[model samples]
Target: MIGCGIGGAAAIIILVVTMAFPGSTTTTSDSSILVDPTKEKQSLFTLARVMIQNTGNIPLTNITIDYGGGAKDFIPTLKSGKTIILSPPDGNSLQFVRVTADGGIDVYKAYREPVAMPGMMGS
Candidate 1:
């Protein structure tokens, strides 16, 4: 009877410790950029930063970008970078986004038309 109680206590402790933090778990970075949904002024325009990470073991290409809710506005290719940005849309575009290497995509609702930039403004 005393041996049974001891075994139970040992099992409970082992279970708690292992369940606290699983050994085989994988962690990922925040890896996200948040921006306001309002339109940016041309006078206050800057290049939005975009991060391009390999993420996977192999390289990827033909990343598509679409904005204003149109798949036709996608970029054919995008490379890995630390920051990516674009000016607000010209018309009724709801979101802007970039595609990931695994065919996954991310979109943003920031305000920028013609993809505002410091030097590219009023071009």
Candidate 2:
């Protein structure tokens, strides 16, 4: 009975935190470039999974991605409809991801706390 009560309280706290802070969201000054990570598959095998879409007619170059620690500069030129996936050095939980394109820069903030997925721990 005591254990059950504690578990219930913990569940409530998790719910509150998840509700207060949502998952990755994008904020950008430019509309040509769209950085979407939610659409990509997030797996433990990779650090970060993101899809960079260039909507403008011109090509995008000198792409830069920055997470909590540092920035990762990509050399490959991005044409229209070309997407790229970036990964952190550690290959794990990323606090946030910031992307800079030719037009402008965009920042995507992650949730404050991580929510556990079903059967991730191999129950």
Candidate 3:
């Protein structure tokens, strides 16, 4: 009887601790950019939808997005904490993306397909 009570108490304590600290948090930098691609596949032979966010303190200007094979797009300004979604030009493969802007902001990311995971909780 005493062992069962102790075990129950321990389980409760573990549960409380887990609830207190569930997951880790992430913070962005002062001059950072986020480039996220949608998980679903694109139809009509177009590139996947991509999200571009100015996760920075200051506004970005003269932003240029270069999709592979001489395809590109331009954005005059992207204010701080702003997000935009764009699709590459038709006939351009979703191989990679290179972004450049004023103030020496440059980023290059390769496209990768999302994987399916079988689980109740995701990370």
Best by lDDT: 3
Distance from true location, Cα of 66 in model 1, Å = 2.1
lDDT digits (tens) for residues 1-123 of candidate 1? 999999999999999886553322111242322222333344555333223333332334454444445533333444433333444344544444434323433444333334445676554
Each candidate structure's TM-score, on Cα atoms with residue i matched to residue i, is 0.31, 0.51, 0.63
Clashes of each: 18, 0, 0
Runs in model 3 deviating more than 4 A are: 1-30, 42-47, 116-123
Ten contiguous residues minimizing lDDT sum, candidate 1 = 23-32
Candidate 1, superposed: residue stretches over 4 Å from native: 1-38, 41-58, 82-84, 87-89, 94-123
The top-ranked prediction according to TM-score is 3
- N/CA/C clash count, model 1: 18
User: Which residue pairs collide in model 3, if any?
Assistant: none
> For residues 1-123, could you state the per-residue lDDT of candidate 3 as single tens digits?
999999999999999886553321112345667776543453433337667888888888898889879988999999999999998776667777888887777777766555435652231
The TM-score between candidate 3 and the true structure equals: 0.63
lDDT of 2 by residue, 15-123 (tens): 9986754543333443366655432234544324555667656677677776656546564578866666665566445556667755564556452433456865421
